[model samples]
Target: MTLGNFSRVTEFILLGLSDTRELQILFFAFFFLAYAMVLLGNLLIIVTVKADPKLSSPMHFLLCNLSFIDICCTSVTSPRMLVDLLSQRKTIAFEDCIAQLFFLHFVGATEMFLLTVMAYDRYTAICKPLRYTVIMSRQVCWVLVFACWAGGFLHSIVQTLLTIQLPFCGPNAIDNYFCDVPPVIRLACMDVHVTEWLMVSNSGLISLVCFLVLVTSYTFILVTVRVRFTEGHWKALSTCASHLMVVTLFFIPCIFIYLRPFSSFSSDKHICVIYTVFCPVMNPLIYTLRNNEVKASMWKLWQRYVEGRKRTVTFPGDTDHCILPAINSLLQYTSVIISTMKDKMHKVNTSTVSEFILIGLSDAPEVRFFLFVLFLIIYLVTMASNITVFVAISTDTRLHNPMYFFLGNLSLLDILCPTITVPKMLEVLLSENNVISFSGCILQLFFLVDVVGTEILLLTVMAYDRYVAICQPLQYVNIVSMKLCARLAIGTWVVGFFNSLLHTSLIFTLFFCASNEVEKYYCDIAPVLALSCLPTYSRELVILTVAGVLGSSAFVVTLVSYVYILLAILCMNSAESRHKAFSTCSSHLTVVCLFYGTTICTYVRPSSAYSPDQDRIVSMLYGILTPLLNPIIYSLRNKEVKCALGRVISQVRTTLTK
Candidate 1:
């Protein structure tokens, strides 16, 4: 075992996991599937954590970084291992082996620190819930993540530099699949006793310390949660369980492999596989299955994905197709028929002839002026933006298609939607005269219903138009003609008008003798129906049945159309085409979710859940915020709109300069 000076070997032959064909094939299949799962599960977690608002907390953010590291680690090793498993010659160039060694340790070390940071995050959240937000802010999270990367890189550099410098004279055979300190240093012609101690100190001791720190942090967190916070006991346990499982899976095998001397063990590759393969695959699954928020976000995204796939239209080329247009049309027709039938069952009893008091959103006199100014600005911006888009669509020849035509209608609705409620709200906020003539309330209700309904149907129409354009580009022009567009737009308004009229008439039929005090800022159906002293089952039934059927029909149509659109996009072979299609659909999908989400939460439930305070907030979101943001969302999304607006602005500037 005495040292001898000699020239280093430039290549090393790896013995690999197995040489027998059957075992190699089995290993290949197992490792291949494990690698794929690692990539897929980690990628999904990364995307979900980044995209979901609910998962924007500090712990999930750290989890996202961990996922990224897992992906890097798996990519570095698994693919190369898989390639070596298939190749006849299992030799790697010296430089390649060195590079692999560097990255594997780099990413692996980073993951250790990241898991430690995650433990700290959990401890802060559980032990100091009151100050969690302030303690683990975005800046702090980013700093912790940066520290992890920096520490890993520095640690890996030291290990790599030490291992690569040792002289290897003759024995160039490596007994493992990839380069590591133990096997590489074992081939050194000189005695490696000090090098073995150094490797153990760097890799083994660090992992051991991190493992101890992680365990101590969890122990304290569990004790604290159990003693002080009984309500969060199960959630704390679940979260800690996942982290402990991952930590144990990661650190124990690493300790076993590196804690001993450089003399290799027969079970080294299997232990390495435990940390390399099993830990990466389990990280995402453990977090997703254990965490409620992540699960909820994943379920929401999955629902959207599934609903999108249900109506996906496939081409014979590479796409999967679903028949949706005929089905969507049937649903719409069915909704209309049900509404018509319900209108016939309810008799109109005209009994309202007086004024009603408005409760208003807030009664603080000090904030009245601020509220007026704020809402006034919102209303003006909404009107101007919507009107601008409407004018642009009407005048621009480039946007003279069914999509923009429906968009024009949507713009018009956005304008009218806020107008019906905002003007009265401003006047009441400013003047404190919270009374409206009964006729005014009826008119407001009628117009509000009409605008909302028409917008719903119109969005469905736009979705259908997109479906045609994407799924059947050849038939787009013929299928979505101007005549059909006109008919669809006019028919939507007509249906909305009749539906509103029937509801308005039925609402007026009820005797409102119980005080004329409306508890909401505006005349919503729920609030108005609450004032009725007579048996209001007929009105409630009609409202529920008609609104439910029509809204469901419109929602289904919109969802189905987008599903087919997505299918067509996925079928497309070009990257640019897929990007463009997704870009277009994302804006529409956002608007759909915002509109439908608020509307459903507001109306789909019983009157018992109606809180004036909650209603005001929900109404503010869909009613004011949505319309205000709609034009911005659309204009930003559509390149043509932005270009056209730029041209208009440029033209105005030139004229002014002249």
Candidate 2:
């Protein structure tokens, strides 16, 4: 067991699928397309599930997870394999080989457990239809998904630990294109009999068990459908058919490869390719083609995207020609900034940071639990209230005016804004695993800024809508047309997108060679910038200059509109008219104050005055409380919204009963 006994191989040569130059190129081309399809197909599934309200069931949620895992599973090996296919030397470092093996089994085993879970979900839905919702409730679904991931981790860790510990002093060329248990273990410089058996039991046994469970579940489903010959039974059987196909394709290959000694078979590479490359590519296609709901959602999503593109391209008047050039210039500017920052980082070698540790809200155990529960509840309520508001606006024609349209957009933001931060905050509070990868932190910060920026502009737009309604009631119809509303909404989102891109690029371009601890619950611009090793004065200045110009412009527009609105309200002769007008603007005004007040306090001050604890609390005010409060404020104050919500609820009830 001692490493001093022999030389350890530092890398492994992969013979790969084919040795011919033409064959390698052909393999590369084929796999590149397969990988692209896997990514695009699975991404579409995820986006469709998230966007379509009708697909908000537990089943679709699990499908979304499956799609994501497929993407991850393929990405672990496919990219490297594709590269090696084109390279002269098909070799991977020992550490990278081990890492690749770790993630391969990690996602692979997770998919096994997930497929089994999906089978159980189908079983419950088909066999126990009466208790389906209760059995597969949102909480239960989350737990099941978490359990699948944990189980995968445990399985993969055992395999990895056993493999990494063995002495690999010679025969380091693996027969397959990727590192795997059988091929890698065969190269170890010791007797791997016991180790191979352990791996077979760990991996092969698990696959066999999951496969058997799925078979049993589907057998029962088929029997139930055969015995009761009903339309519902037939429909359930059709759904299970897709899961059955996926299980067969995924598990059979896994069992074939893992259920024996570490002996090389000529067919091993082919079988490995089936599960690793083909299964991931096919799962999304099978699901989308077989499942009507997913197909419908995808079609709707595509239509929405197409409509949005048309709206973006086709402006009202001669504005299209003017706007196209501005958009192109903005895109060019973004590209220049990104390329410039990347070059600077490369020259200075300042991009050495790998990950960040967030010093979350509180470290005390007692307070951590309290904060977790508090934020969890807040997040759930935020999602429910915002989703309800969005559904109401979409379904109820009575609430489809420009005011409700903007409100619907706000509700969507409320859902998105908290979602970006609160889940991570809760995880930090509960598990204390506050480390986020560098790319992850940048992404979180980018989205957080984008949503916040959009909300600021949206609030200003909402104020203008009110001003048109109250101050210029006669011109409101002509001024606040749907086309104009669409343009304004689109503009806010585009501006937010560019604004976030600029700030995120600028902040990350700085040297982060010092501490990588973000001193807040989640990644934010200020906390992340605070950790930079280089001077952040220029970045801070840019943030301030942009925020000041944008924020002040929005604030001034809102203020002037409100000033005119107030004058119009006060000039009303009837008290009833005044009350109606005030009620219409009250909810928006309250949200505006909450949003602007907290954001200004957090971002406008000098860095020397920044306190982590104080900033955390202030961030929660806008980040957490504002989203939670928007729906409640609007729903409680506006009778029309309340009525729309009631109608939505009744419609849902009706649908469920049917």
List the global CA lDDT of all models.
Answer: 0.80, 0.86
Residue pairs that clash (backbone atoms under 3 angstroms), model 2? none
Residues 295-390, candidate 2: write the lDDT tens digits: 778878887897899888765466666667878987898788777766865776456788999998777999999989988999999999999999
TM-score of 1: 0.48
Error of 2 at 396 (Å): 1.2
User: Residue-wise lDDT of candidate 1 within 461-569, one digit each (tens)?
Assistant: 8888888888878978986888678768877887887788777767776777657888887888888888887866545655755776677768866876786677679
Whose TM-score is greatest here? 2
